[model samples]
Target: MSFIRLATPLRSAVPRTAYRRLSTQTTPEKKSNNTALYFLGAGIAGISGYIYLTGSATAKVKATNTESPLDPKSFKDFKLKEIIPYNHNTARFVFELPNNEAALLPVASCLVVRSPEDLPEDDPRALKDSKGKPVIRPYTPVSQPDEPGVLTLLVKKYDNGVASKYIHELKVGDKLAFKGPLPKYLYKANEFEEVALIGGGSGITPLYQILTHALPDPANKTKFTLIFANLTEEDILLREEFDDLKKKYSDKFDVVYALDKPKEDWKGETGHLTGEVLKKYLAKPELGEKVKVFICGPPGQVNAIAGKKDGYQQGPLGGILKELGYKEDQVYKF
Candidate 1:
């Protein structure tokens, strides 16, 4: 296999906000005093019943006119006004945002979409929040940052996946409320010399954005290698796009597909992506020194490759990569 290297650095059209660190200091005395003051204020307010009624009415009106405060970056609501299928189980949803603004959803950021009506009371995914309203799960965006007005999410169906099923059943003109640009795993362009993408099934969605953005930009110095593990040849998503990228940007991209089962004519790598296979495809440990690795898949594959007991912990890439002395900072799990 040939290794591809970038010819130029990739530049992001949108300016990135500066990273801020949070202060960790705390005081129990201040906490206790604030709690006491809050309760005392509440008790006084309760005695004036009309004050509470007026305040509630004002709050309701404000909520009705304003956007959801839950959005961290103060983004307006975007509606799913259209849907297009990429395959039998996956789809690309087109979201229509306010003012026909360019849909610039960053890679790894997800949108929390919900039906106009509340989910059925008995639905397992449906649960009452503190205010007794049902909450919905979040889904990541698969569309590019520059794609205008239409943000796409490539969703795969599962037998018990409530959100996926609901989204798939929708027609072109259906309206679904969504709020986001919620933060998730992200890698700033040109931050690392080399990047490795390890993905399985629908886990490829996030990596797709990363690869597309990284490869096309001349200002981005990052080089990428993808080790995509799937059940079969037919299970591989975005195969044509990857092939075209490999051919066009031969010096900046490399891809290896691992299938769980191989047919008679199968010629590419086969079987699960074990430690041995990782070692064969990954750059040497010396090269890994400047490389940032991203792994995403089913919990089992992610855990096995991530080599962590708890799902949240970050560590060296599992299997042979760990055995080869890769450090914790060199690998990331998604």
Candidate 2:
């Protein structure tokens, strides 16, 4: 049989569970005192009472916090509520929010996440990069912006990934500090006649966020096409959700998938995304600013499609998109 060596596993586009241990050391008097304090605080709040069972387990936000729990300026610690294994190296992490409120993030934004500050310096869970600076990563949330009580992230594990490994080992109720709905491209309904989202592996989250927010709105008249690439059939993330979108909004949405290796029965496009595939699938430059192409993936894929991002700058547009007659203004690199 002919064989194709696997490509380097896609670096998660900068993107787990365990059980928390309970202590049995509390004396009855301490417990009574804690319980009294909890109820006293709840009574003080009246209708908007605090209902968290474990004191100090959840992030502290203002008691009058409203609309969203995320603060762009400051880090807040949120407890892990659940973990669901999605594939061999991917999972969905659900984090608890204060008082059962929605994350309320704006469309096409992300959260900056890092290990809790309290971890000891030598602890394995404390993640640091090469310079020993605390490692922080941006993740696009998988749940809807208005999804209440929790925020969800779809994360793919990379072998040398410090953040992924730290997250995978966490037990339920463990905390991670998070900040921001750091804005990406501000997407608005009907602004574009057609939008093309090209993503690979874990990069799908941001594209998914844009679609979920836009497609269901009664005011939406925009059309969307997603060209998602992956290593194998099983590597396709959010397949079910995309399929449902195709069904419900048949006129407004469609998806094309490219796989590096394919099963005998596979029917989608084969091989990595290329100028040819993009030429076939992406909206034409002739459509002007009314058409937007968004690309997000591993560095290799993003660089190939739209050129490397220069630090925080979008950098100069080059590569397949530029070669195919798309302008820098017509594309957004995520």
Candidate 3:
């Protein structure tokens, strides 16, 4: 297997001196002029600082205009109050929004939960559905961390999927306790000029968070390209929201749908995500050199795109990426 090195974090540059003494043997007049120049420089620095502060405050207000009142820090103590089904197999769990002063969560973070024991084996909130079937699973939140009163988790049902089945059976007014504000993968805004998101099945949850967070900020200047693959066109979730984001942020966001089994009239890309196909939609290897890749999905799909071999290994993504000469550190798996 080929090995790739992770990139080290970029270091901040040292500040440069504003002024330097010219010839220590300068005359008295020259010394006086130098002192005057120093004060002038100080004045300019003060003005610049004030302008920066004012602009920063204005920007914060604009960004926080629709911000959530629920604090993320207090997410650990929040309780689940409702579960709304999104499909036959998927549901959105709603938590009783926290009321703490510092409960706001950072964008791209997730809430963690430890399921309770001692509930009836057949209980809907337990690890089983109404039919006493086993169910229950872990998932990331789809809603913004700051939103007040309600946190939604989009869960897809699978055959013998314990978590999903239990969630589907939950009714309004029921309490399902959970702990979180648990950290998840986050891409710092403007850290890179471009980003590529590769997702399969429900892996799109985190990708959606990143895309939505990036699309609204004009200052971010980070472009995004998404490669979403699923079993079939009907299996693709969040179709409406993805469409809206594409339309609203047309200049900065691009999405390509790849279905394993597409209908006759389907016009978009199709088939499994192969090296050749990824190369076609992605920027060249050189462009990928500076780009960060986020991969999430079934272990096989994630492993394939991330360049893993012999099941899931610790090494860097292997296949086409290594062949294309992309660096290992550029890829992050979730």
Candidate 4:
């Protein structure tokens, strides 16, 4: 949001007297001095030109180096920089970027990650899966798209979950192969009057990505309502960040946390998110295209809410959202 303005350099001017002296001088000594002066001037001009060209080339190299580290077409290995524990099962993993640069990820996109052991045959020690393929999974980063120097992923360890377990076990200096900027639905300001984000567990991340990208824009007029379901209060990921957003963008954003098993002092809803619960908070289906619903979570939760995703494609509408009269186009599964 800030810009640096470079001041223009002042051009040096030659004295009229110096030109007159050169024109009037007839002595060989004066002519020789003038010739020496001309040579000196040429040398200075050559040095200046060389410096300018070198500086321009340096600037171009710097620009190229600052480009986003993740490539959409190929997998690149990024070394782990730091890890911060979030809860009993979840942690935030930070990976170093080669140069100081932002992730520059598009809004609502994710990266595909796989273990280094799953890399190509060039590595003699590479491990092969029993299924004869690498275990790859897509994950949305909780960090902002423009966060520089590193990209961070909020991961939760799931029992027998290959990708999650691998991420959880990563040490600070280890590396992971990542490929993406995998495009999802790119949101524009005021594209919809209302957006209902329904998610469970780590599913809140993509929803978080959307809201963070949207609400911060001065032109954003859309209202967002998030219904996040978790096992308990402790299971809610990015709770503080969402709460801060609600406080800062009160008119444009709000969130409802649903805990399956809440503590005695908890005041939020305590039950699995159901169709009835959704109906109460979501925009009326009659609003049609003005309203949009996004669903992401564990397979069961997503299926119960808006039907299962058929691999990379969205499956048929068959769940609570369908019963509630939400059309296929009005809902998206991530």
Candidate 5:
């Protein structure tokens, strides 16, 4: 029942639905129509017939002075090299950086993707207060950060998901504004004796990022146990990749699958992550911070992990973590 303050990124990384908007101030009316306004995700790049964006939602990048070419502050334009369809609702966006760009992707970072064009007027995801703004979303890359030459995102398409839908519709060769190496978590080798990775659906991306970084390093003996939840067999993403990693690092990694709608032959656990389920799978709190838990999923799952109304302000922890006697620092919500 102890309440501990969560980290800044963990508190702010709450999944924002497309319809939720940031607090916006009204722009002053200008008599001229051709005036250029600068905002995150507001720049455009004209391709052969289609146009993609080449701007950052975090800040405007100056080509003259940049800390590093790969830095998010130095937002760079990339071209979509390939699209691999994973299932009916998800596609992998493989974007390629210039040959000279930094290929090492920092562990557990993200990218801000902005569509060049705004959605139709009647679309629910279209900007409400900031009508002139384009749709954007933060996504974790599926490709290992150091995997040279390309950037890949395993995105799940939602009917009303603005960025996800737009990305799903993109063809190979289309370009988009990709600005980031937005580091969410700073991980060290064997920082924790044991860690639990809990994720659902598309939230599995970050968990995968951490998995790839930790399991393969022979120097890092951090043991990982992942509990991934999905609606059905079709919704389970990166199954092959996770399986491969588990086999490669047999002693260090293990994965558990949870399904909501199982077929007749389904043989694993099912339903949402209840306290009892967590008690059985999650590491006990005896070692304090030495044992850690990371969670990423839709709103409901995040709320359950971080606590209902318990973020930034350091409110009391709730849900399974609270029920399990885990401290706030011991659990991170992504």
Candidate 6:
């Protein structure tokens, strides 16, 4: 609701500076073996996480529902209500919902977006081909369903990405086709005595959803630890909010950062997500279902921790978890 609502697409979004390979075919969406989104970062004032939706105990009960927001096969049109630029590559896209219905979602779910091929084309993006067939991009909702009138997505822009490119090109008042709050994971109150979320980049969105949802539930006593990995200190997302969570709920929540590059002042772990970090931060696997591990992020991290993807199915739990004696059911990929 605090975002900028424009009547037309901003010319700034169009690439005025010439770049190579503008006409190359858009790549298909990769099937992630990565666990449903779960990651963390640190920040202080005005964190970008607020650009999505930061939760509180008071706003908790409003966004609960288990139905699909829209039919996946049949697209429902939603209007672009606002656009909030979070950083260089990420933006908070706000869309108006059709009505006052339940937000049609469960914990850790996503919807697909498609561009209309019927629009006047000044420059063709990857969303549709000449034949008008649309490519779908699945994105998890960052806004709580209780946030009235609008659904929010924290989008990370990509140069050759069909859906991201199409979404980036959209202006105010543009209608986008969306469908499904396809449930990825059904989380219950204190299903696990402890949950460890491992993620990086945008993968943290789903983890954020689960964290916010759990903290509000009086029945959920699940302690949480977040291990977020990124290239540099600046790359860490939602740092301040995570810090605030840890500060306020220090008894229940903990966060760890593993940056590939760190400054002199850096205090947390610095390296790839390896077994040592897992052993130090993650709850011991001996607890079984009382402790569950969730991972999401780069294919390398996912592949390393949970093995690769055979299409959408996880290949094997063959990395740090396996070395540490964690079983398949004990871990899940997003």
Best by lDDT: 2
- lDDT by residue for model 4 over 87-163, one digit each (tens)? 99999999987776778888889999887634564453333345655667899998877766788999999987777
lDDT of 6 at 287: 92
Best to worst by TM-score, what's the order?
2, 4, 6, 5, 1, 3
By summed lDDT, the worst window of 10 consecutive residues in model 6 runs over: 31-40
Model 1: per-residue Cα lDDT over 208-229, one tens digit each: 8778877888886777899999
Q: Candidate 3: where are CA atoms >4 Å away?
A: 1-82, 100-103, 116-125, 128-137, 308-315
**Model 1 misplaced regions, further than 4 Å:** 1-70, 73-77, 117-135, 308-320
Candidates 1 and 6, the one with greater lDDT: 6
lDDT of 2 at 102: 84
Report the C-alpha lDDT of model 6 over 208-314, residue by residue, as the tens digit: 88887887666668899999998888777777778988997887899999888899898989988888778998888899878898888877888888777666676
Error of 2 at 241 (Å): 0.3
Screening candidate 2 with a backbone cut-off below 3 angstroms (N, C-alpha, C), the clashing residue pairs are 18-171
TM-score for each of the candidates: 0.69, 0.79, 0.68, 0.78, 0.73, 0.75
What digit string (tens of lDDT, one per residue) describes model 5 on residues 171-274?
88776676777877888889999999999989999999999888878798888999999999999999999989889988888888999999989998888878
- By the lDDT metric, which is better: model 3 or model 4? 4
Model 2 lDDT tens row, 1-334: 1111111111111120111111243455676566456554544444233334434435454333456788899888899999999999999999998887888888889999998857765675577776677888999999877667889988899988888887888889999889998999888779989999999989999999999999999889999999999999999999999999999999999999899999999999999888988888777999998999999999999998999999778999988999999999999999
Question: Of the candidates numbered 1 and 2, which has the greater TM-score value?
Answer: 2
**TM-score head-to-head 4 vs 5, winner:** 4
lDDT of 4 at 312: 89
Positional deviation of 30 in candidate 3, in angstroms?
Answer: 90
Query: In angstroms, how far off is 63's CA in candidate 5?
Result: 22
lDDT of 3 by residue, 224-284 (tens): 8999999888778787889898999888888999999999999888898888888876665
lDDT values, one for every candidate: 0.68, 0.84, 0.67, 0.83, 0.73, 0.74
